[model samples]
Target: MLRNFVILFPAFVSLFWALLFMMRWKRNSRSQNIWAVALLLLSNSMSIAALYWHDYEDYSLIYKLDVLETISTLSFIPVVFLYFERLTGVKKKGQIFRKILLFIPPVLMGGSTVLFYLIVGEERAAEFFKYIVEHDGALSPGFYEYRYVYMCINVYTYSAFLVVQAVLVFIYAGRNILMYRKQLDDFFSNLEGKSMDHHRATLKGLMLFLILVIAIAGSGNLLYVDFGFMVLVFLFLLGGVIFYLCYHVYFISYSADNFIMELKLSDEEALENGYGIMGEDDFGNADTGNMLRAKLLPQLTQVIEEDKVYLQNDLRLDDLARLLHTNRTYISRFIKEEFQCNFSEFINRKRIEYAQELFRESPEMTQEQIAEMSGFTHASSFSRVFKQCAGMTFREFQKGH
Candidate 1:
């Protein structure tokens, strides 16, 4: 009964998330597609193993499927990293090189199974299975005879690959996050890495998800515990991913547009710009920077007023630049020099100004309605920015009115 559950639990979780992924996949969401594929790999491998568990008569078939299992697992490690890479907007300059390094592990890990198939053959697979569950594990007396070969496939293969992959994933994810934090700093003097920003919040989720993946993947194969008990742990890992998938689905379905709206790019614009508008380092001045503030500042104000661009929740300098038909650095300087504030404050001030208008014009709008109409992504974000700009909470401001 317990054994049946170990298999059923993960298989069920996998199937559920697979449905969610498929739904999100229909929406053409790249993020969902990545995870959908990963879940499918985990599900298929475990399902195969479970179906054949009692059929030791076809033991070679099981071992071969385990080899396939290892490959399925190998498929997961890099794509998980790639998911973060794609999410965090890592620059593409060195990606080719990074991909090469990323793929080396799966390739190196594959060599283990090939060598296993060669020396041990299907006949020796049963013995290999015994070695895993008993003995000192790889230290069995016969292991020394063909020691170097056996150790290469067992000790030096996926075991080593996993360790290196964990270190690399941690360094890259952390580094990308720190750089993005710096970007938030440069863009808005008031904005902090407070996880209120959807990107930062999602980064936290990504870190959690990756940690769970590493912990489970590393330990699952080790089976250092009883194999039966280890299966439960793997089920727990699947549960963790399902939780992350729920989070991922929320963002993609509900907030992804809010986040993308911050870029103010159409899909075409994103492709054309290569999403390059926001990350420019030289916010100093472009050739067009020579325009007199007296002449250009009013145009900036006009665009914001006429277009009502201030109401976008995740609006960025790049969006403002695109609106003004100028470069982001120029817009960055415009907000600082003309408004004497960062982008967030400049935008929030306008939103508060607009919210104040709605208060009088409609005289019946809820704070939430006002917040939404004014371009806030959430009530909390709206209230926080409103309070910062108004010198009072929304209630206090309402009372004052």
Candidate 2:
């Protein structure tokens, strides 16, 4: 009973996640959804291989199932890379190449597994399969010594592939997430409805979780112990990890979809408004990035100075980019290339300058009131930045006044 549960528990979980992903795909129908669905197929293949390897042990069919277990034991990398792809704005034309690259390892592994079985004769393979299963792969050497060595070597080699792939995905995905944070002065502003700090922490947590998965999966193979016990431990960990991934995927999709929709609306508005955001001037001269900044600065300065956009509690690069009829990348570049600072610093400096103006106009206005009018969401945060930028606390400034 325990042995069957060990195999079926993860199989059921895999099936559950597959169905959930299918439901998600029905609604979203994205490129990532296809790979996510493919990852689940590999999950099912891995689970079935375990069931046959242990329960239907000592059979020729069990050996074949074990070979095909190469369907991708470490399948999380593709799923994660796809998730980050949309977030980082990978173009659709290039995704076909990325999808093919991600599948190369699994395809090679599966093809080799089939080739290995075909090269061995029926009778000799049967003997080999029964012996390995009966011994639980704790075999020494016999006439089939080379075959045993081959199988052991294959497992370790595949584990190495999984480890390296996970690390690479984490590195690439981690850098993009960081870039997104820095480019948007309003970190949470571009996240649709979610909190900025929460989502950034979530991205970091996901990368760490992938590392944890590598450690757990790698440990099981390294520890030569009872096959059944190892399967039990592995499935338990798999269940927990799968649940974590599904929960996060849900929220990421929810937020990203909203973000895309909002951007679409802004695009339509920009087109209708007839703003020359693409560096075109009235004289019809094409403006360079620097020239574009010069052309754009007057309109942007007027918007902030007269309209008081910085006074809004929530200001996003997306909102500014849309109004200017440009893009987030351009806006971020405008700040760094033109102003010598990142978006966050640039926006905060504006808010601080506005706050100082407020202080001068209304001596009786509380710092809390000033913060509310200066685009800060919290009085505590406003006070902290006020001191940092002005070189004195609110109390000190107030006392001088």
Candidate 3:
């Protein structure tokens, strides 16, 4: 019973998270749904571990379940990549075809497992399973030849697949995450809940988890290590990491779907309201929009400077554009051209100046207090930006003041 519980713990944890993710399905986001499915498949995949840990007398039954086990294990790989793909907006055209291609490896693995079973036959398969369990894979040249060849092929192929999968997923996910940050900086002023920092942390955790998995698998296959207690420890750690990932995913404040939807609405409204965010290409003459920029620049400066719109902690380009009766692209371009920064940087620069003013007025103020007063939603952000803008740490700036 202890062995059974130990092997099943991660599966149970995954199922629990799948249900939790389902509870939020009313939010109707593709990423959430994909994550729930990934967890569900992960639960199914955990069942294979039980075959190793439990004292199963029915070798035939174990052979019969091998195909399902193989499918479950390999299927989670692509579903997980799909989840991150959607979360980070790396989705492209031909999505259905792409998904089908992603699923090919799992299908091939399951098919190969079935073919191997048919070739070995039920009697030999049971004997093979019995031998491995009874002897801990210590087979003589007589019995070992078949097992050794097959196990080597299986382990090496699976290990190679895992390595390639990890490389592709990490590269694409890391690149997309960096792009996500740039997107946030382009559109948002105060990026408290808008950042992908949580996702980046999760990616790091996944890297460690993958390393553990590779170590365990390679050690088990090649080194003939005792797996009973090791498997239990691994399951425990896997359960903990899954719990951390699920908890953070469930409570994540940022939603890419909502962000994109809001941006679409802003664009549609801008087009309908005669502030179409026209570019130089839209105008016949290169300098045609200079008069409009000349007229709007002062109003933009007045709102940011005199009216102190930058003090609003959740300020955005759309909000500023609405206040100035302009389009987002126009405001974005104006800030870039006139102030030599994006909207986010433009707002943060003013906020930092305000923070400096506060420090001079009240040198005893805390970082958190200054952050809140100067429109930064977090002190950590304030501290980082303070160093970037002031060329010194907050403490150094405060001491000088």
Candidate 4:
């Protein structure tokens, strides 16, 4: 049974990691994608190491496999930290220092591999079996002395690193949960009459589940015997369960439904208050109900007036959502339903409008500067959008209009 477990565990871990990898691939590009791919590759390599251990007893082969596993294991720490930073929207300029810290573990593993090769020598390294069966069929072992020490170092180092990484993630998750809770409180505070207990409940529940998953996965690593692989599997299963539960809860929960319903409440308040703008039939409506715009038009107009949203490079849906005190879904839906466009189009329209104004008023500002100031992270995207929206290239617009 033990032998079977030894052979099967790595494969199971690999399969779970592969599923996570595929999930990240389908999402938009972000730093989390980097962490997901790194972990997926590390798990795959660990799977190969386990297979090699089951199939080969050659000391040299074992040494090489250990080297590969050590390298992958060591990388888990920094990648995890990077994932946390990206997910939290925290950017530190001196991040290269963190990258340097990540290099330490791999370098140590590589050094140990070289040291083992020198001490064991080629002939003995090739044939030395690391384990032997006792006369009574009980366990006995024989391994290269220095290599065993190296292995211990590798394991202990990775375990310590894992603990540290897990703690960091836990702390970050806790902070985020608190912030989200506060935001929910503020949002609900303004509501009149009936309580927003249901919406608050669902949102808080989802956030709590997410925090619990991270906590379980992190603490499980410390408690479990096999680097928490089994715990990780359970975590994955739990996460999937929670995800489906939240999906149902979100759509069916009266609070969330009420929130959506609020979009339609008080048509006069929606239209006359500048919170909602009526679009013509040209904007393609599947239903008979007229699409309304955000009631916070003055606020949005102020954002446009200040030109802050478009001026910042690396603008994202979440950023805009944060600024608007709304969720990404609402912002995305508003852009789609009211503007008859997507986020990129909505952003580009604002940018192009600003660029046109700049071109006319400030002939001194270069097109490149205009593009940068217009909230484009890249000149290419700005140029493409400008041409599409203005019916002319930036230079042409500047020169002709």
Q: TM-score: which candidate is best?
A: 3
Per-residue lDDT tens digits for candidate 4, residues 72-107, read 655654565555444333435666776676667667
Give the residue spans of candidate 4 off by over 4 A.
1-10, 16-20, 23-26, 29-32, 52-55, 92-94, 126-129, 132-152, 155-162, 165-401
Q: Give lDDT tens digits, candidate 1, residues 201-221.
A: 555655665565566445533
lDDT of 4 at 284: 44
Query: Which run of 10 residues does model 2 get worst, by summed lDDT?
Result: 183-192
- Local accuracy of candidate 2 as per-residue lDDT tens digits, 1-401: 67676666655666776777777676653634744664576575657555544546446766576556665554556666776766555344666776677767677666766666667655556666666555655443653645654554456656766777778778767776665555344333322344344456546666655676587458633322355576577766766665565555555543344556666776677667754256323224444655776777887787767787766667766667766667665666666666797666666778899888789998889888988888887887788778877899888988987
Candidate 2: pairs in clash: none
Q: Which pairs of residues collide in model 1?
A: 311-375
lDDT of 3: 0.75
* Model 3 C-alpha lDDT per residue in residues 1-401, reported as the tens digit of each score: 77678678888888998998888798746877888998888787676656655667898887677677667767776887787777767556776775787687678767777787778788887777666666665643455556655664456666666566666666666776777767777788877876366777767766765666567556645322246677678878888888777766666567677678879998888778866656545333546677777788789879978999999998888888888877777777777878898888888889999999988898888999999999988889999888888889898987776
- Candidates arranged by TM-score, highest first: 3, 2, 1, 4
- Model 3, position 338: C-alpha lDDT score: 80
TM-score of each: 0.68, 0.72, 0.88, 0.41
Q: Which stretches of candidate 2 lie over 4 Å from their true place?
A: 1-9, 29-32, 49-54, 74-76, 91-101, 122-126, 140-145, 182-209, 216-224, 227-234, 254-265, 277-302, 314-333, 352-401
What stretches of model 3 exceed 4 Å from their correct place? 1-4, 92-101, 138-149, 195-197, 220-225, 277-280, 283-285, 289-296, 337-340
